[model samples]
Target: MKFQNIFVLFFAVSMFFSTQNIAAQSDEVVINEIMYKSLKAFDTNDWIELYNPSDADLNISGWLLKDDKDTRHFAFPANTIIKKRDFLVIIESKNKFTNVHPGIENYVGSFTFGFGTDDMVRIYNSNLQIVDSVNYKSKSPWYPETDSLGPSLELISHELDNSKAQSWRPSYVMHGTPGRPNSATHTEDEGIDDMLLNVFPNPAISSINIEFDTQVDGDLLIEVYDVLGNKVKTILENYMQSGYYNSYWDGLDESGNPTPTGIYFIKVKSPNGILNTKIVKSN
Candidate 1:
């Protein structure tokens, strides 16, 4: 009886230590590289890649990529297993891929959605703990040089161009070829000289408000464009004072008729340049 008791005690202790080791190993999994390919200057198809360096597979089930207000959640299937030292590509559109192994398909579904150019993307683990994030309000280093149709992992070197998107910022770049460790002091270009425009009550039912900030008095043109770049409505087309301004659109067309439910662009053009943001109308 004494020997049996000792044996059971030893087995219990061994199990406890084994569980601890597994936990420790999971905590060590780190993002070795993050690359943004198939990009354009101000527009893209919303695709990204994540690289892992550890040997153990990453169980990203229940992981989420969210923005402010935690209102939008991009959920990763629990069965998803990212192999060690491999790359995972996520797109905002749904398409079939033969490159992904059969086991991985059960966890990661086809990319079907994307965040807006001015929104935020926060990556979280199974425990709802934040692992990585990027804000579109800042200039991201990983800008797309070409479309995704070129190659699987083709990417361009990061450049410091102030003329392009200013507020977009890159959240992370893993340590690898085409990936560089970003500096903590790095920041997007100052937006002081640029006019910031915003529209509210998006997914707007009947009407919406347009707002912008300027430094000097100048002519501001606020136009609504469809996906095909056709002008739908002009909210403002004359010179305005150098201050905050508001304009309301009552879901009308060029002839003051109700427009259909669809996606539209709100473009604000000034002497400096042009800025376009998206708005959705429903009902």
Candidate 2:
């Protein structure tokens, strides 16, 4: 009779510890950002960013990443450790991604498969138990801009329930913030202007008009970059007062030669902040 009582108590204690361990594994690390759709102009490979918000280092070696149907699965290599409050990005193709935007150092893997516009992403522990999952979409309810050449879906906060669409927002930065803190997590300073830079007559035939407003006195630099991130032309560069200004680009390169018709990015730098907008040059 004493032996039976001892066995019951031991089983209850084991079950309690097992439940706690599972909870820790399921919530410590999470899928924080996703870029399943690339911009139309500067299209690049898709990616997923994982974040560890806990205070302790996590060894995720042998963990698995899978899509909704389990058709695509990627396993973390051995010795894979994510430092506390750090991020890790999984690239679909390193060559493709680096070709568009170079000098990105923090990341891992080249998952061969791509995610659907509306799909599921699940992470499982080494024991093959589900940890965290996100079912993201590209339509309304989800940020519509994330569906195409605008921004990637980013979790607003690590503490929020990432599985819900309401907890996500379109990344303020073009492309996406990978291997770094999410852009939505940062607080916007009211003192700085939003840098409402506008480009008119998009798909311009020969020349493009640029208008911007500044809130403070500072040097402003405006340049045009090609889809491959090459500097094609400098539209304007000078010190300007806090006021509205207009500039123009004549669809020409630095050498004064006519540039080919294609998609280009107009990057504006001012006292408040830097802003980027897309322009299409048509023949």
Candidate 3:
């Protein structure tokens, strides 16, 4: 009985130490590469690439990537996994790419300020723990953060480059746009003509302003509608100039009385097309 008791005690101690080693090993997190290319600063619509250099497959499900605001959380798919020595590219477009394996679909896409800017990209693991972060604040080669264009990430080197190897090759190339790049230089069929429509004071307390740009002279119609598709007011219905124009609308119905605090939609219809955005009103 004495020998049996000693054997059980040894086995228990061994199991405890083995579990501790496993736990310690699991905590070892490493990021291989974070690269991308951007045109201008403060452009968040650029393409970004992330590389996994280690031998272990990275389970990125439930992981979160955020910018400075942390308001926009880029969630990885529950089944998303970055294979060993592989890379993934994220584009800030709405088009869905379901065929590509490492191509993160539009669902996992995110926008960021471009290169040469002061911006931060942070990644959090499944436990809501910040695994890694990249800050471009003091970096001279990087772009400065501004309101107009966001930052961009570019991958410059590949696996063997770490060893100063001449034969090292970059695994992939990624690029992104700030606003829509001008398509006039390319064939008309290959490029898209973009129009700009913007609103100020998004979360407005009383009134909001709208603006747009167009080439042809036409009449502009601005309207406010509730989420239920009920038209509350028509702010404007008149001919405007070809260049940019601004108009304001107080948070009121047709009778000029204050509307209740709620969510509303502001739509601008011009000769170019229709642009709509949601606005919140607070008392």
- lDDT (CA) for every model shown? 0.53, 0.80, 0.52
> What RMSD, rounded to one decimal, does every model reach?
15.1, 7.1, 17.4
Q: Which digits, one per residue and each the tens of the lDDT, describe model 3 over residues 179-241?
A: 222111121112113346677796789888887676667887889976445789999999877
Across 106-133, the per-residue lDDT of candidate 1 in tens digits comes to 2244445554535545667777777755
Candidate 3: lDDT over CA atoms? Answer: 0.52
Q: Which candidate is the best by TM-score?
A: 2
**TM-scores vs. true structure, each candidate:** 0.37, 0.60, 0.36
lDDT of model 1, residue 35? 27
Clashes of 3: 27
Candidate 2: clashing pairs of residues: none
Model 2 per-residue lDDT tens digits across residues 100-191: 55767667788878898999989999999898999988886886567775577899898899988889877766787788888766523322
Q: What value does the lDDT take at residue 229 in candidate 3?
A: 55
Q: Give the TM-score (vs. native) of candidate 2.
A: 0.60
lDDT (Cα) of model 1 = 0.53
Which whole-number lDDT from 0 to 100 does residue 140 have in model 3? 28
